[model samples]
Target: MPRTLRASDTVISGNPSPACTEPVDGEQAEQPVLGGAPSSASLDTLIQHLVPTADYYPENAYIFTFLLSSRLFIEPRELLARVCQLCIEQQQLDEPGLDKVRVRKFGPKLLQLLAEWTETFPRDLQEESTIWLLKDVVGSLARCEEAYCLRLHQVLQALHQKLAALGPGPESLLGADRPISYRTQPQASIHRELLCICSDPYRLAQQLTHMELVWLRHIGPEEFVQAFVNKDPLASTKPCFDEKTKNLEAYMRWFNRLCFLVATEVCMLSKKKRRAQVIEFFIEVARECFNIGNFNSLMAIVSSMNMRPVSRLKKTWAKVKTAKLFILEHQMDPTGNFCNYRTALRGAAHRSLTAHSTEKIVIPFFSLLIKDIYFLHEGCANRLPNGHVNFEKFLELVKQVGEFITWKQVECPFEQDPSITHYLCTAPVFSEDGLYLASYESESPENHTEKQRWKSLRSSILGKT
Candidate 1:
């Protein structure tokens, strides 16, 4: 039998458990069944499982799993308040004769549950209002039982320190500190030595991998939840995870920037020979990304190369070898809903799961992962027709989001190349219109319609200048 953390196991003071430790399929992990209700219990029934009775506390694993994914249906603060209220009500704290008896019975367990929450996902309590509510709840408990006051204060202090440590440091990325528009600096001001410094495709791939890992690390699971939640027209106030969603958007902008950068590199070259070399170079880089299991960059490179501006260069295409590019395209092909890439991603994930070194990493095509999560969220109702929390749906969300959390934790084994990194980040990339103009300049229009487009593009581009 697989050993799971039991209710008696304290979540505080030992080595930290992973964000999730639920048993996989074909395994029987113990689940909390409040009031002997089945897994299909209502949300109110599930919340009761969290309140400790005289003889029972919920399992540590169940608590962690629930708290991690609960945001899909309820806000953390609201949940915390509800749980605390339930505890007070269950203990009958207002009753004069039984107050001491109830406190003696349930006070320690209540403190333990609160500590478990704050310790496991302290970020949920980072908001001032949440912390204030927590302190108030704990204070009321403390007033009822003097022995628990110091322990409660200790939990609050430790949580404060953890939140403080999460703040950006002096060396953190400037772009990550705020939500900024994804605008590239003009080509005239950029370092135009171009790809001369980053000639080795493997080195360029390593640098790109490093950059991708850094961006991935800054995003939190809350960002993924909030990204699709606010789409409901009925959402009133901004969700607490709004800033986190900005981080997710910033990562996406990085992907877009990389795509535009690849296109710009191919189109900006004046000669067909140079354009072909750059195309081949990018293809080689994309291949390296594939071998290294960096699918996001691989897709970005493929996408930019397939854009109309770069794809229309027949002369450039004629000069370059196309065999490997075709294979990369096939792997990323949208046909069959990217079944090929999904298979490749699964292989990489398995490799990472068993490997001793971080070299066996699997950074997925993140936007696709987001889309999958969004669809899953949209497809399922937040509550059952019977008004339960939809525990089954929450379990599936845990599995998907948990996989991403595992991927994000792998440290990039590649060393950074500062000059190449600077070049990649600061390189000027043209907008779509500029790309069309660049393509026309390289190869004159083939027909009357094409001629009209080229003339109009030239007039518009010059007018912008």
Candidate 2:
């Protein structure tokens, strides 16, 4: 401790002063940034260490591995295989969270794998796994736009190839060996879910329209038309009617779903011009149904179709009802009243007279106002032959009966017309604070004086004196 030396000799001899012996700054040393490329040895070490752990890893860990592997571009295929396995497991477990995370992490890669598998595999394997995988990828992509478009394009391309191979037949694309788990209800559910997620009515409408086109082409026009017609001879039977009713009900239900998608979910994608086109198509279909006398079908079509300026619905309904009435009238007899004719005339007289003859004679004179001499027989008595019958009373009775029968015969057709109900049932009435009041313009002094005079006269007439 007491040793001392000269500075140059002490430095040379490795005996330095304490102040010069301070350590270099660690902060000044170079450091690698996070998320940057690691050295090859480090990556190798990571893969070796992760392999065993990844085997026992839970679903979230697998997803994390997949995402990390994608960005790192190391062992992507191995990670993707593990992810696919996890996805299959998640589906079996029915764990929505795990399934969603797997889909979100690896949907694009899975789609790529599915496309490659479909191309590489045999026809049978392609039909079994590839098609199903494609469908699942599409379903998953509903949550991610980029993925959805990529998968959708892939599916469309695959579908085109499948369609080509199968040719123009129902069994071609679907195939006999492959099981199609996609039923109407599930398809509808998927469509609804997609609509909810996208909330883009135009996109939904476009998707549905494309689906409709594809399905229609596959089914063909003849089969589609047959589906709409009343086919069952046993339709009167409860079971048959029930089945048909159920089919129509399903169509109606799905139609309502489409309506909501177009109206609410697709608001962002909608354009006035495009909406007008849709409306125009609906009107064209409605007109076609009307021309074909398919009123019930027309009503169903109209009910399920969407239009803007909702008031137009009232006008459309009015047209449909009017058309139905016209058709009904055409189908029935043209005489003034079918019921009255059937009730008043005997069988022989009914058979003897034509509808036109009945209209001219019996209907005009007995059911309508007799405005001309043509309504009466040229030489017949004006009064009944019996003396007990008073002529004036007979004419009055005939007039009253004629009016009643005519009113009963020709139904007003419209249910809520004021003139049809003599303005009674539909007229509006107003009351004020538990009292009745009459509506009037402001009264003049002379009118007020006249009202007072009438009140005085009424009081005098009822006086005790």
Candidate 3:
């Protein structure tokens, strides 16, 4: 009484063909297989039942069928396409529904199908679609176990080999100047997906390590380091550098990232000894730049380590000044001595000038030194056991020195000419009570010249005025 199915309707209508002319006995056709007895038309019934739902079934069913069926019996591409679609849809939804859906029921099946597809699929489409799907699946499966993470790593390694064979052309898997537009969509999506996964710290740590390795292999280590460092939101707050590619700013960024990885849960490398080893590794990488006289890079790394501020840093300026004096005393090349002195002076000037405006940079060394000097000379001397010296008493001794130095204004004889007279004439003198002595005068050129000669001779022979 039922309508007969036609060959033309089989694919679309999910029916068996009418070409089988053998008549089914009524009882055999009507009876259900029971007690482990084989059905008369098991294969035909399966094909008929499965065909209708194949296009509309959910991920769990597709994964199940792919694993249970022989490779020859299923279209792997279509199966993987369904898996990818399921992942895309799942990711897009606000509620992931992972708890309601059973990954345990489906995970092994999916992994098995993936392994088979990796061996059998067309190389190009396999590299493009299948590998990407596997990466997503691996990212999903990351919540499972160390074994699954290891399996995903193996898959990625195999995929990378295929990608590498494409050579240096556009087909190459990685290139620095590859258009940002190509990366923008996937990277944005992946970043969001990663953020979601990172809620599970264990999974995130594994995923981060996996991604780091991928980046390291695809790009060189320096570029990998830069990608993380440059992407850091805090980088702008720390320091800015010139546009030069090779500089302290670049190295500092790299150093900071390495430290961040070691110190945080992102790497999960939390032993004190291990951290020290990582720091040592970073220093070794940095030493190459340091050897080329990159003091700025060295300083940046040292600062990032957050080590105790070096006690000897205070004495650095004094040591530099002393070394310059030594060079000068030994009659070394005056130019080198002058250069060394100027370097130290400029460094000191920069510190002092910066401190005058921004007190934060003034370390305790200079502050304490200034405080002690002022206390010893100015503080101790003024508050003597007796009353303060009267202004008239201070002036009396000063007047005597003025008269002794020059009876009349004169050109300084300290040097051969009038040009040097100003310095000699303006020199300060002090009385026995530590009061300052000073004088001012105006005189004709002849008197100025003679007075300056006597004052100069007295100063030179008797020590400075």
Candidate 4:
């Protein structure tokens, strides 16, 4: 390996620096065309640019962009190892006289590059191999120059603490620590009991906001970074991938549970008036969630109320008022690509930005946000025709995901109601089939279509029993 790189050598960074001319592992690196446009560069070119030269450092934007997109093809540990190898080879530590001079020139910039990587995506260092490689690199630097020892160790320590904090806590692993009460209550008695306890719609909304904020707060950029990665065939047997995306999965499950809970509450009631009352209660809860900028919960409640079983209860709906529910549905309508919902989200976000109180916070429907990001990622090319990274695309991704980072930081203004939260978390909800069966029982099949459907449901339920 030569100490000085030639200008014609391939480079991913916009600033052309000397690079190794030989194709890494017999793979031909993509060469830049005469025009400024980048052609598709080899993965090795991208990795080489990550190693900072004594006089030059990779731009911050480029560093963030590469680290994010690189993970799609290669694991973080391997990438880190390659970077360490390049840094060492560049130094050419075999010669006694030049060692001190090269280390002195290159050491701080190397530390800076590593610091940027660790700070931006600490989760990447979760693997033991990556951590060991990082320590080795830092140790080598510490040995070369005593001045870097303190800062290098500090970065390492902070990373360990961060990884520790990111580990799942007891509360996350197990639902509410205390045992759920009212487990013994019969199905018939439980519906009425639940109504009496959770009668206050405003209070219910408050408790829901509390839970929503808790989940949102813990979700880091790493989750979104890995959102588009293809699932491994063995992900089910291996817990690693699940742990990486658990906060996202848990939030989604919360949405589903709330939807089923709303449906179960309505269908379980024997009397039309009681069922109508439950419907009205949930409508008000949805309204309150909207007022609190809790669109996620609002959509869950609205979706449940609109479920087939719940919607088929013509008699129950006739008795209930739906003026407020209609407005909520309109705002959440998926028409025109959810233009109404997007407008509402923008307003809430603006209010949050300008408001004096945390109550003005906005939490967008997270699943939709993830969908938007996935499309953004897929829509753009990773490399330009001239062989440079598509840095512009990454900037757009950062802007979108950056807003979420801001939104999650808002403190929930509502006071927690322990009993309401407990009930929300622990109350047993009926499955979809159960909800349909209960719906038919609440109101007998209106005609033959209903009669046949009801019959099939009965047979299925009985057979399962």
Per-residue CA lDDT of model 4 for 1-465, tens digit only, reads 001111122112232212212223533345443122123455787677668877777767667766876775577778888988888778764334446776878888988887777776788876777767866766676667787878777777777777676567323533433321211122643444456777889888877888888778767676776655666744432123366666777777777788877887888777899888888998899899998899889888888887888888988888988889888888887666567888999989888887866556788877677666665665565555545454445556767777887887787888877777777777777767777778887888999998887788777765422
User: What value of lDDT does candidate 4 attain over all alpha carbons?
Assistant: 0.70
Error of 2 at 424 (Å): 92
Rank ordering of all candidates by TM-score, starting from the highest: 1, 4, 3, 2
Q: Please give, for residues 39-69, the per-residue lDDT of candidate 2 as tens digits.
A: 1123333333232221133233222222322
* Clashing pairs for predicted structure model 4, backbone only: 37-386, 38-384, 38-385, 38-386, 38-387, 39-385, 39-386, 39-387
Candidate 3 lDDT over 1-465, as tens digits, reads: 001111111111223222112233333342222221112233223233222121232233322222223122224455555555564354331244543234444454445545544532223234366666666665665554336657766665665665464223211222222111111122231232212222333232222222222222222111111222233445642122333213223333333333222222111222334333434433432232232222222223333333211111222212222332233222211243223323533454345443432211111111122222222222222111222111121122223222212211222112122222221122121211111001111111235654574355335434445
Which candidate, 1 or 2, has the higher lDDT? 1
Q: Write the per-residue lDDT of candidate 1 for residues 133-249, one digit (tens) a residue.
A: 766656666666776778878888888876675565212342232222112233343337457888889888888888888787767666777665564668743333355476677
lDDT of 1 at 396: 68
Q: List the RMSD of every prediction in angstroms.
A: 10.1, 41.4, 40.0, 11.1
For model 1, state the Cα shift of residue 194 in Å: 4.5
For all candidates, the clash counts are 0, 3, 3, 8
Off by over 4 Å in 4: 1-42, 53-55, 92-109, 169-195, 231-243, 381-391, 462-465
